[model samples]
Target: MTALLAAWCLCCSLAFASSYPLIKSKPNDTGSNLLHEGHNNTGMADRCSDRGFNAITLDDKGVMYYFRDQYVWKGYIGPAELINDTWPEVPVPVDAAFRIHHRNKPEVHERMFLFKGNKAWAYYENKLEPGYPKLITDVFPGVPGDLDSALECPAGECKSDSVLFFKGKSVYTYDLSDPSAVKERQWPLVQNCTAAVRWLGKHYCFQDTMFTRFNPVTGEVHPGYPLDTRDYFISCPGRGHGHETRRNATLMSIKNRCSNRSFEAFTSDDSGKTYGFRGGWYFRMDSKRDGWHAWSIGSTWKGLKGTVDAAFNWENKMYFIQGSQVTIFLSDQIYSMVQGYPKPLQDELGMQQVDAAFTCPHSSDLYIIKGNTLSLVDLKNTPRVPGQESSIIHSNVDSAMCNSQGVHIFTGASFHRYKDPNELLQAKELPEARNIAAEFLDCTQ
Candidate 1:
């Protein structure tokens, strides 16, 4: 009876201990009023769900704005912002958008058009045009309402400097010079283009998370039609080998991928890019994404070679540990290794055989994990002795991280999260490990 009562009390304490919601999971976002009760603030809605973007357009300066529902991503990779913040006059749920760019017609060229339902909005440099919020029928005379997507078709690559309006499987080609003479045709290449854009003298159409490059004049979709958006457009971490199934491709279970499996090293850098390493490959986890994509260490880290044992970002520098060696790289526009790096772990920090290394917010100390022991080493002293050494909850931890919110001890594909290091040491007994992939990394069943 006493044991049962103790177990219930422990469970209650654990439930109450989880006060901090995991980072990048939602809320405290933008610090804007938009981070309200029900509104999603984790940039790219639903934690990197690619249901599809409704509209995409490039500004006069060639800056891309990808819109999905009420949020807009300024660049390819984004912690998205509310549409009203950028375009206060423009309404939400934009169906289609396109910017005009013509050297000959400079007066009207920079103007952009956004379509939704029966309404058409025109803006020049983000300011609503004098006469806008016009009906779609009035804007193009014959263009249908509730457009799927739209893009500007320049004359050099097209028959005319026209605008392509997509709806369902059909397209309406409206020539800017001759708006009355609208041509409509069934587009067999792609159906219901979710968003379309004219980028750097080329035209591309998107359907869902898939896209196709095509010629507007010849109506020819390039041979490699319907490519995954993450491949070229955005910087999506935890990405797989193309969403489309290929005949020659070998499918691997989630167990094989570090994203859903054991991690050799894990760190959330000062730049806010969360990375997990396994073997020779590393996965960059986006703040707003519940996905994983792996890249080779040799290819990404340049000079860094082989699998890493531990990684941690301190100040503006990133440290990668391998066996008894440690390599430090500067976190900047380019991650360049510092001079005289790849130093002996013992010689550099007086630590040996580190299983994992991590640091929490506002702390100048690095926590080194070895077996079940943790050694707190100050960054101020090199070849330093341990300041506060203690035994932690888990033994033989595959990897670990102290991501501001809490400390996670990763083992195999699962992770046991504790509120903090002090609490874990106090508890003695480890908590039930949760599937890291299932909760945030989104493993394939």
Candidate 2:
């Protein structure tokens, strides 16, 4: 009876230890007010009221396309365009329920495709043609089975390749070798293959919550590496084959279970050969208060780096968002020896959840797409002296596109043609530009 009582007391102590403090601060404490305000501020609540944007699609040339449901729209931004500038809106080929699977670059023209119900259709654009994108092929060949996911690999110098599609647990490799003759070869029984990417010189497939690097050249599946199935979300930021070297190529996985709320970061040293957990970040929320913390490899949870809700790494720099503020760090240096991250990048962009952020593949500028706006900051554009203000380009945008050509901003449905800063500035006078800016500015409020 005495031992039982002691065990109950210990359990209660642990529960109390993890509980949020009832009274965070005194009533008249100014410091308390600041803390309260910081915690209360959650960017434009409406932007995060729902998932800001569902999917971001980019073409080989780096044209960015995105879809927003609140307004019910789909559009693309050209490489040279700014987000706030006007761009042409492409009507959804079928009905409103359809979504884009992948955009393919075949020969000299680009094509957009969508998956509807259990079928996929390809859109074609011809410089001198009058017809709209025609339904090219019904790639799936089974009883109303859903078209799971798809990706396209641009044709390299000597190898003429095409897009790859996955359905159920199997993958089909399409040959765009001849735009006139597109062929698909099925590799059957690729169990639980939720995601697949053409990486290194092989086709890396993710199945059973694990990664299997398959050699397209040899048609053999290599041994699989185990991954935390709890965190199934993954992102691949590069293209097929030789481009692997130039790609920082990191995969981000987040576990959203109420009890197991944590995020994991994984990177490839040599194209998915080995994946080690960089660390895990967690957020705890109860009725009254919420707090964030992190744990590095082999370290206790008490040794946290910082409190963060979301994080992404680019060009060796890790950018984390906590409430409305943003913080940056040289991940290797910080995780190795530096105890803490350098001071955060000043809150110049105001309170905004990093809806989407990525380093430009062709340049050193860091591009952040939030809500309906885009902000650009150069890593090298910082002030020479420490703690001094640095210049940044803030473009009131609706969408962003980053590719080999450069970063482009979209103002409306149509991509405005601009060569230099002067042309882009003059574009604001165009009718489409004015309407888009008016619509986007209203959303900012």
Candidate 3:
């Protein structure tokens, strides 16, 4: 059985190299070709046929379209599935496609370029632009004639180039600038792969039934990779063979980013629901619901029109903390602000200038954070009285929240947890809670 298993592994590894005709001629002695490089050969052929998505591209409106041989699935960043039951076929079977959204150039709308063999087609507003299906050599000067996959990066995140094109076993980059030059460069170590996508600030290479994440800056595959393809995309074996049915939830929403304003947005979470505010914008994340819904703070919470610096829920009441002002409203009252509210923290708790706040999941104490300091506000204490119990517990807190697990605090990129309110938050539940907070609260407005 051991010998048979070894033979099977070798066969699958060879099949991986042989499956891509474009990469067959390349030498296999490079460090990127080591065993456990991208994906194991086992069950790869079966999984490959299951993934009906052949190509993917993002539209001008930020809608991602996943192309199959016959149908195109489109939707916003999250909850994207097939659209228009009767979709038109591409001029040619596409090996890859990407949209060019000129952010700086407002006059130029988005244009989708579909690539196949040595030719490409440009489309605008879903209509074929005039004089398209141009030769790759003529349109994309310096780019290789054939491409297995391609992805574009927004201007802010891309290091050397805005567009990355993959062919055979190597990668090329197009700066998307004047003179239009393509550089033969490699990072995150590209090897045998079927497709690739740029998500957040990292690169993902997909092959067969597995996927691996690489830190483009480090030129190394990040630890804990070669993940199952199903975790990121719909895994349906034999679904793409022929007469494939429509697949929903084909892509994970985490791949999408919200906005920059959420770098340190005020946030609160309860019963799996998270509410966040940045400036006058507010977004609520109902884990039970679909995508996030963005609303103006004034519209969502009447009489509130400033950045929410801190917030929490206590006794079914929602608290909005902005600077030294603390406003209270009934959790059930989604519209009007509470009467005789909007009191100053200095007058109530003797604490001023709160930054972020949350209630302890296990106790009655309300945790308020300001800069790096944390103050435990005892809810059981009487208000307007000097004996109101509140103490400074810790310093250097970036954010704090109470969930069912314990008291979670964010300092720097680390997340510390304490199951008991009286205990110190010693366990590092999350390595980087700041980033997680961004995603959990839909911080990107």
Q: For this target, which candidate reaches the highest lDDT against the unseen true structure?
A: 1
298-334 per-residue lDDT for model 1 (tens digits):
5446578778989988888888999989999887533
TM-score computed on alpha carbons, candidate 1: 0.48
Per-residue lDDT, model 2, residue 312, is 40
Q: Which order, best to worst by TM-score?
A: 1, 3, 2
Q: Count the backbone clashes (under 3 Å) in each candidate.
A: 5, 16, 5
Candidate 1, pairs of clashing residues: 43-80, 238-292, 238-293, 239-292, 239-293
User: Pick by TM-score: which candidate is best?
Assistant: 1
Candidate 2: tens digits of C-alpha lDDT, residues 1-445: 0000000000111121221111112111111111121211323122112232322233222222332332221111111122222223333322211112233433324444444344444444302123423333534232233444454454441145565566665545555544444444456534344544332122444553344545443335543233321121111122112123212222111211111111222211111111112223221111011111111221212223444443444565545555466555443311222245333444433334544443444345555555544455565654412222222233443333333333334433222333433333345343323221112111111
What lDDT is obtained when candidate 2 is compared to the true structure? Answer: 0.31
Of candidate 3, the 10-residue stretch with the lowest lDDT total is: 1-10
Which ranges in model 2 have alpha carbons more than 4 Å from their true place? 1-57, 61-112, 118-133, 138-146, 154-159, 179-213, 217-219, 226-445
- Candidate 3 stretches with Cα past 4 Å from truth are 1-52, 75-89, 104-109, 178-180, 216-218, 235-445
Clashing pairs in 3: 50-236, 258-444, 259-444, 372-396, 372-397
| 323 Cα displacement, candidate 1 (Å) | 1.1
